[model samples]
Target: MTGARTADPPYLASLRAGYDRAFEATVVATPPEGVVLSQSLFYPVGGGQEADHGTLVTPDGIRVAVVDVRRMSGAVVHRLEKGGLVRFRIGMTVRGEIDWARRYTHMRLHTAQHLLSALAFDRYGLRTSEAAMSGHGGYLDLEGMLDGEEPIRRLEEEANSRYFTQPVQVESAMVSRAEFEAMPGRSSAKSLPQGISSVRLVLIEGIDRCPCGGTHVLSTGEVGRVRVFRDPKGKVASTRLSFELLEEREGPSSPP
Candidate 1:
């Protein structure tokens, strides 16, 4: 926690600036689990989103593969592969670069999840209980029952319509916890830790506004086409809806 500060890390701080794939930071602490940087662009695993995989290059030209990232005691820890610990020392400058292909896919799938979740909540009064994102697709577990394929079909149609036709813009902002709680239709506020005084809200234009820490695309159009389906393994009390982005003629794209 040598360089730890109360302000948001580089990954969260740059989210509104369209985020960064690479960054230069100084090694501030070397904990038993991993190394902490003065600033970092690697996203740690949280909010149902996976951690970012990347590489950290030392000033002396040794490349250390970052296998995992996690937030520990208010610090972002970049866990490196074996033998990487000896290559870095406190106060040394290093360059970090995230795996863009994997990160871009995450951005697309995460935004698509938001659209689908918003639609489900508005159309059927369902609340999203859990979500998991992957390179190929993602899924959202709703708190209520969603019977049959008709609802899934309709949701899929609505999501694609918004993506291809209307193309809603996505934006994010940091707000006081009190301000966020006062806002209408706020969800999952109580689940946040009591020490967090600020909340980050992701707005999908007029469609959705909820508390989220995950990365997302700048617009719905970047999600391409989506395919929504019901997961049979969902709990009896809740419905799990999964989605995959269809292949586009333009192929995979990155967020700006």
Candidate 2:
């Protein structure tokens, strides 16, 4: 893969990828241990989602711990733990596995973000100005001032109402600018990089649909419960909403 930029989008099949994570790929570049691959299972850090962490086991049984993944100059780069360079070499075949448990949590929270952001835009005319996600929880900053009393609670009710009424079946599609602009739930493109002509849209059915590159849950039901909280010392000029995802269980709980 030397000097060749990946022509095909680097990922698994959209339909099957919703549930599958493991795949085989060849090392096209090395030294830093993340350069190019015949195909990549790792989601590079972008669009408010963290990169995947896992182990790359060679055909000969050597293991390289993947600590971070990124993309530069159109090449996907996987930064490895110390000593990884000593164990890996170019032209080696390896099995690539993503940290699915952590990735899944981000997926759940990410999908929940789409629904919540859409609700803010649809109901309150607020656009998502910025967002971030991690394994445990995350937050979205809206592009408008929230003036009503108990706004966080109200947002939670609106989001959860739509979330619970629907199954969490997720669908992703690639489309041009015009096609994406036609979607109903489109919100602030803050989380997206500028100058992107093609759009990757992940839809939570009717609840929300937006341009995004982050991994999301297979469906909204997987999101369980969504709680919206406020930052202390009252509000900022633009509303910032912090949220957490809780799994379905007796009484109350948060995902571990």
Candidate 3:
């Protein structure tokens, strides 16, 4: 399949009410054979994890198989099987639906990661590197060593604290491409692209303001509970931090 193209929609942030408007959308671009769904909720694999897996539907009421999804040039692209592609054209609208089970898992894990980033900064004055959301779980690379279990446990506790304290809010703003390039911490970043009018910033209540293109839960509490799993390699210089979602009862909290 060809490289994915950036779509105007932001799957991670654009989600508000589920199934707001399901309709037929035509393929705006010349997609590869057997492809469907010009726009989708499937998040292409990036950051260190695999892409999303789901199905697609054609305008003629045909079901196309979405074998994989990926991100390209700020747009999310869906790759289909051989038979999935048809003689699609621009302005052709195809109905799109994501695997909610998989998407929700990713949402929870991604949000948990931000909370983990906040925990690292809040407790030990550490910063995160190389964060990823996966099917089984999620992981965030740390610049500092694990030191010990105490720090990890403490970070987990703080992450939960932030999750329950307030609602999570994410907003996007358009800035001059030059201004975006000059933003603090934008230079050292590895995953982000330079020079763009729109920047998607994620804020976890009183937590953080980092650029991200990943999907997240509407509220931090929606992440449920999180537990950090430490890698046994246990290299103090660098370590992989993983997390698992725990089911929790929702208390009365306002969503942002």
Candidate 4:
């Protein structure tokens, strides 16, 4: 039952820039499902990405666990664990911090998807029909077939070689809907709803550009080496590339 507010939320702020994992904001309302913060960095579930889990600390030092986040009716609702709702109230100030390990893994996996999708489209004229990411790994379903394991091996090798040698930088920006629609290899933007005049495009340097609202690493190097293979559950017409970050000496570890 939170009323409308004008302040830009933290997730939107980080949408085109570096992510701020922790933030402080006022509680605007406490609906039955969760607390509505005046501003929050927690990413709600959307764009085939998972919601961010975190903790919210009240001004009086009581720590409440934020078990889930969702965007409801234009507001970001931070759902608390059972019995944690009583610690918050309208107008109360709180500090929120996301689970960095999970968020970072998501960032890496998401960027890896973009990389692999770009490679597939560029090398084989295949378009990504779907993509989903998790702390464990991610997958992209392409509109074409890989024919055999050799193509998969080549795709994986090219992705890893680019990561180690070229290290493409990833960045996001807002473009006019017209510009987004005009860009080549932007089949993904076709799914965007109407009335959106502007679109956020995630660009992997010279590699690819696509409309996306998910968090990503700053560079392909941060994604480290990836293992790209055929998904056993893929449909008959489409080829699914299942991928995960291989553990590297300097890269983030896979979630347990």
The residue ranges of model 3 lying beyond 4 angstroms of the native Cα positions read 1-6, 10-23, 30-38, 48-50, 72-76, 86-92, 164-191, 233-236, 248-256
How many collisions per candidate?
0, 4, 17, 0
Error of 3 at 165 (Å): 8.1
lDDT of 4 by residue, 151-176 (tens): 99999999999762357777778888
Overlapping backbone residue pairs in candidate 2 total: 4
Model 4 CA deviation exceeding 4 Å by range: 5-7, 10-17, 164-166, 248-256
Candidate 3 RMSD to the correct structure: 4.5
User: After aligning candidate 4 to the native by TM-score, how far in Å is the CA of 43 from where it should be?
Assistant: 0.7
lDDT of 1 by residue, 70-145 (tens): 9887788989999898888988999998887677777777888888889999899998888898767889999999
lDDT of 4: 0.80
Selected candidate, larger TM-score, 2 vs 3? 2
Model 2, range 157-184, lDDT digits (tens) per residue?
Answer: 8777767445756788888776666655
Worst 10 residues of 2 by lDDT: 247-256
Cα deviation at 27, candidate 2, in Å, is 0.8
lDDT of 1 at 230: 91
In candidate 2, which residue pairs get closer than 3 Å at backbone N, Cα or C atoms, i.e. clash?
34-78, 168-219, 168-220, 169-219
lDDT tens readout by residue for model 3, 61-91 = 7766667876655456677777555535556
* TM, every model: 0.91, 0.85, 0.76, 0.91
